[model samples]
Target: MTTTVVTHQPGIIAQSQVVVQVTERDWSTSLFGCFEDIGSCLCGWLCYPCFACQVATNAGEHCITPCCVPGAMIALRLKVRARLNIQGSLCNDCLVDTFCGPCSACQMHREINNSSNGHLQ
Candidate 1:
């Protein structure tokens, strides 16, 4: 766990302490369980225990690094401050409604097609 204090760099003083918290995930759990959990996924904003997270959060920005699928979701759970206006591309395996993001039906169709064409692993 880590905390950070940021000031205006000038004589103006503005400081906050960020606390990192950890939670557990179950890979076998259903999709709905992950996204709809308000406490863990929607309100957890101290997942990244580094200065970069503090900087980004202070600037009101979300990280856009290419992380693994599950890892990305986990990070989202950790760094989210409030509900996002997310639009596009939910995970293909899980059928969670990612706001304005990818539709669950379309994802299911793609999966069916891939499996039928022997393209799915």
Candidate 2:
């Protein structure tokens, strides 16, 4: 009897295959570095709710997501961290959002602004 194997459907990796991995990265700016971006800080301090909307928009999310969707801010944080390869967990995102919400928003805004891609545009 003869048996044949198909390697196309699900794709298979050979035993000798090599995988490359890059070290996990942290956010470009510190979580508490609100002053690092003066414009974002002013926005966060002056009009918080609107600032949140802007942050959402910056993260390529709907402008109203933070207001309409519960836990949207935390979700946005996770998405941003994941998209940028930033090292973080959902629990940490939730905690940071709950405690230092304004600072977090500023950080996200700065991150998006500093990014070169058109992920937000």
Candidate 3:
């Protein structure tokens, strides 16, 4: 008959030394850098509703997404930042949306317009 012996370490534990590194990126443009894109600025200020719809549409959301979704601006900001690898938090998004709604919209509009991909840009 063949016998098998098993060894067990009851007092020792194995740990992994693997570390994951993530790069936090910044937005291509500043939040209030509206002058960088004339078209977006004009669209945002002259016809705010139309501008909002256009921005939402470009972001792969319904044209009226801003109108339908509660706190849509903040959520959109979070989504855009996440997609672009930009570093920020929901609280920051909310504060920016609350105080600089138009500028934020214009910035996002420019960002989406310049993004290479659909909506996620």
Q: Which of the numbered candidates is closest to the native, going by highest lDDT?
A: 2
Q: What would the per-residue lDDT of candidate 2 be over residues 9-66, giving only the tens digit for each residue? A: 6666546877999677878899878778787798898898899998898778889999
Q: What is the lDDT of residue 115 in candidate 1?
A: 30
Better of 2 and 3 by lDDT: 2
Q: Pick the candidate with the highest TM-score.
A: 2
**Candidates 1 and 2 compared by lDDT, better number:** 2
lDDT tens per residue, model 1, 9-117: 6686677999975443333223344243333333223342332233233323453431224344333323321222223233432224334112222222232232334
Sequence-dependent TM-score of model 2: 0.79
Model 1: residues with Cα > 4 Å off, grouped in runs: 1-26, 34-38, 44-121
Off by over 4 Å in 3: 1-20
Candidate 2 error regions (>4 Å): 1-18, 117-121
Residue 33, candidate 3: alpha-carbon lDDT: 89
**How do these models rank on lDDT, best leading?**
2, 3, 1
Clash-forming residue pairs, model 2: none
The lDDT of model 1 is: 0.32
Report lDDT per candidate.
0.32, 0.84, 0.81
For model 3, residues 1-121, the per-residue Cα lDDT tens digits are: 9997868677878887999877977777898788898878877888877887877887778889888888987888887877777788889889988897888899887777667554663
